[model samples]
Target: METVRTVCTICPSACGVLVRRQKADIVGIEGDPESPMSKGFLFPKGLSAIEYMRHKDRILYPMKRKGERGKGGWERISWEEALETVTERMGKAKALCGPQSVIMLRGAAKGLPDILLSRLGNAFGSPNITSMGFLCFVPRVYAYNATFGCFLYPDYDYPPATLVLWGVNPSETFPPLFRRILKAKEKGTKLIVVDPRRTESAQIADLWIRPRPSSDILLCLSVIHEVIRRGLYDASFVERWTLGFDRLERHVEGFQPQVTEPYTGVSPEEITAFLGFYTQGPSAIQEGNGIEQSLYTFQMQRALYVLEAITGNIGRPGGKTRWGNPKLVERYGPLFTLQDLIPREVRERRIGAERLAPFAHYALPQAIVQAILDGSGPKVAFIMGGNLLLSWPDSKRTLEALGRLEFICVSDLFLTPTVMMADIVLPAATFLEFDSIHMPPDFTYFAHVQQKVCQVGEARSDVWIVNELAKKLGLKEYFFKDEYELYDEVLKEEGITFEEFRRIGFLLGRKEYRFYEREGFRTKSGKVELWSPDLESYGLDPLPKADPSSLQSDPSYPLLLTSYKPYPFRHSNFRQLDSTRMLHPYPLVLIDGKTAASLGVKDGEWILVETRKGAARAKAKVDDVKERVVVMEHGWWLPEDGTFLDHNINVLTSADPPFARETGTPLLRGVPCRIRRL
Candidate 1:
């Protein structure tokens, strides 16, 4: 009984599945109905991938920290003494605080160990790697590469005649794009949804809208000021491929919909019936991580790419298209993260690259926990597969900047609450025990081949722990001569061999709609910058701007908060899988039944919440959401009662200082907070 097939690298919807195996005992996991992008639809965290790869708190080997650091003590060591104690504490923290003090920390995007942890921090010269990409999906991929230089996605094969769903729910974080938007809402499209919770894709929306929670950039500049005051743009593709349409129509004419309806609780006839069902034609929208955990994340993703380039919906056909990527696979930028072997003053010392220097390729988990609580950051971290003490924000200032780290390590599988502040843990493996090349995130333009169906004890593979910690940190002439010679040098420009990409299990790529009408929009004004001269040459705000004092409300934190991703965890991973904690057992929150009966809360009780950076608890349900909001549920922890930071909603978030100044993106949605009845 073998079965095998492959793909589910847990999250990033790399679905596909199959597994079964009896010889080395996986014994079942299904889905792969010939996956052409999750067609066999398997979620519940990919059918509890064999109960989260045989969990019982998995972590199969390599240990160490027998004392201090969150004291659950360890010891069992040996993967050559946990790679010679993480190569002698990262070679004495790169010989006394130098390889930019050694940072790394990654999470989400577990494929090719996120380009082998940026090729092990650019071959150990370090540029402070960091992740949760400024509140996920890299500030909507740096506001779709500063407006229309790409990242559009959602073509769902040309069926959309209107789909919106902004602040996305894709029915619990993308169930294969909510079963292709429920087969394009049974062929008539026009769904809408916007979200301030009531979401099972807003009870099958044909218009749901809810606004006010970080007032989605004043409800997207009042729906781009009533779609250019009702002309409903796309005026011949904004006069042949836009570029600051009269400075984004005089900067969204001071956001109108009746003066931004009491700060976006939406109405001006529901922003003119959400621009009459989104400019009535080839629409698309999608947006999510609820406007990428706002503080106007890159100006609400550059006002949803200037509302999909003035509704012509950039590159048409069910709109927002532009796919392609398999011209022989080797992607992940700056030459697969070797980044010219780190120079330019050691990549300008990356701890938040002197104020988001165009997202200095990664450092900003709240500016490396405020530069490791201000001793100027990174005194050794490494992390990988993160939990950043229940997913970073302010869990009491990320547990006091990871207890002011002076060497940490981690790599996971479970022991996580940021692996009890590790001093070396390791284990890892899973996605059915290793073999690589998955791909499948957002643009779903395919790549496949995640084979390895077995191995458990002595776990490994985060590309064999970054190729044996780049050969004990001497960086081994910049890594590779292993993990299938790093998957045959990323499929050596398609000559093949990673066993012919696991017998061509997948590769797909070529969709190509109006690629900016034959090579335009890559920016520096090759069209579609809609008021961006590259964000006024990176000093930012060349267009999308809407503060409204960051949606006011703070009569002593009078309830706002937000958070979601629940369909049985992925962020802080499968709560020690009892079949994905029996399909999400506790941590709930929700609220609005008249603000949980004006705060004397009820539905399954429990509560608490709080905020101006603290407080946690959970339980309450109350539902239908919006009035004075609430929501909760993101990646909470229980792991069979180890209870990390008591139901961590990033211990009431707040990585501080305004943020989204072009992707330092902090706020983690709406925020304020208050609740109680615990």
Candidate 2:
């Protein structure tokens, strides 16, 4: 019998994995059947974990850049030399700037963020720490905090009365959750998928609606207006629990179905009919029905929150609502450095307009890059988990800003395009080979343990690396220790031992429901805040409205471009994996059938995707999936075309600030650009 315990690092899903190892190496990876979260199922990436390790571009040991950055020039070096160089540069940076000048930007790596983020800035006395979340989920978290005073994460197990799958395609991103949706479907629950493209999840849904790109705010506002106009909303709930319903009502009064049809390309009555599924037919329609959406995404999430709240679906078993679970203080990985053990500053110094872009003003990286490149923003950048250059709103300009970083450090598995530019690049252990603990869904309270399977070279867990660096910076005496010792400290607080987590791969307790309690919501007033004090403090309009105000599209930009995550990929990783890469080996642009026909373009041919900032070439995948939608997976390497495709795609994307009112989560899916045949 082979012993194995692993976890998927493919994406944030963090699904529990069970591996079969021979001697000291892993031979196979599968979903842990023992896991209550995954139920023994795995995503494509999880099943092909071994194959990913065998990819061509994998680095086996520590290496230093030997040539000009981004030239793929590297020289293998000892870990001592690597650590020394990283510490030297960081020390010099800490000396020149008041620690606040240095910025730590990390993404997706396991168990290291809190440890590094909390300590790195405070030790240096800087609050400029940011991550890929600065570009992704932080906005959602920010909105949830501002609106409901609690995060109402989508609960797959919650018995929803009417399910609305919007923007997100969890069937690919969260395959395990997809099964939960399927289970709901089996129980005669209605399914509705809303997206700009005819995604796999959308194709199989009971209703699929592809509205105009970037028009989600308008589309949702219409639904709310219709629900209110037809008296479909739960009046008692809105009258009692909501704030600014009157102001919000005034905003949506003029946004009738007919008014939104032109702006959103969604017919008035079809939108009306869709609204009917949840809000009509007396108790038969939604009394116990669920109105769960796939994080609707962008401002769309804000709009969906309104629908759920007005319907009294909130805190109901079968409706969307907020969850409150005990934080997994125990088994949550140890604080790696004494510097990090120091509590972070609670003053919450204003994150400023640029910092607020993802949370407040959507397309912020464009401006953030401009400021950085001009030496106007935070001068030093330390990136940890995420690859921002490849994941920002405008990839092209992000690359340019990356080149201008006075000091940059990245801790990542592979030397990504962005990593190539780092002054210091730390090696990170793969997920299957890390010893850490986490709350799978960051909003929930379940704890999953990630234990090592095989020694993949000498890469260290990020916790170790951050601790090692802090030790060099003379901050070790506080709380930093080798992982096991630190783990013991963390374990002591939770009544869980390392032996317990290692044996079970997780230490779980009885799951608690977020809402549906006999009492009421966990809000300040004990009722969900459709109106809240936080929103008013943030100077945000305290009402959810369909405010789809378009930025003036230049005539030069004739089409709308959006990037979507594919089934077998995460960020920029695994493109080199044979099993996964075969699905769509290279970046291919998708165009609507009508758009292609009109442009004298055919499927599977080279085309030029151009915007004001730049242009790139790609093969076309013409389909009727979306009338005017064109998409390409992000983070494709510069060497993609026969080992060097010049189409970095980022150049053509807009570097403008995001288009959100209170939150600035960039509508990356609705950027403006036109595709032309090569």
Give per-candidate clash totals. Answer: 2, 30
State the lDDT of candidate 1 residue by residue for 354-444, as single tens digits. 6684544777777788878898757888887788877788787888888888878888888877787888899988877878887755554
Writing each residue's lDDT as its tens digit, candidate 2 over 43-79 gives 8888877776655555557677776766767787777
Cα RMSDs, all models:
23.3, 4.3
Off by over 4 Å in 2: 109-115, 280-299, 322-327, 330-368, 377-379, 441-443, 508-525, 638-645, 658-663
TM-scores across all candidates? 0.34, 0.89
Error of 2 at 570 (Å): 1.0
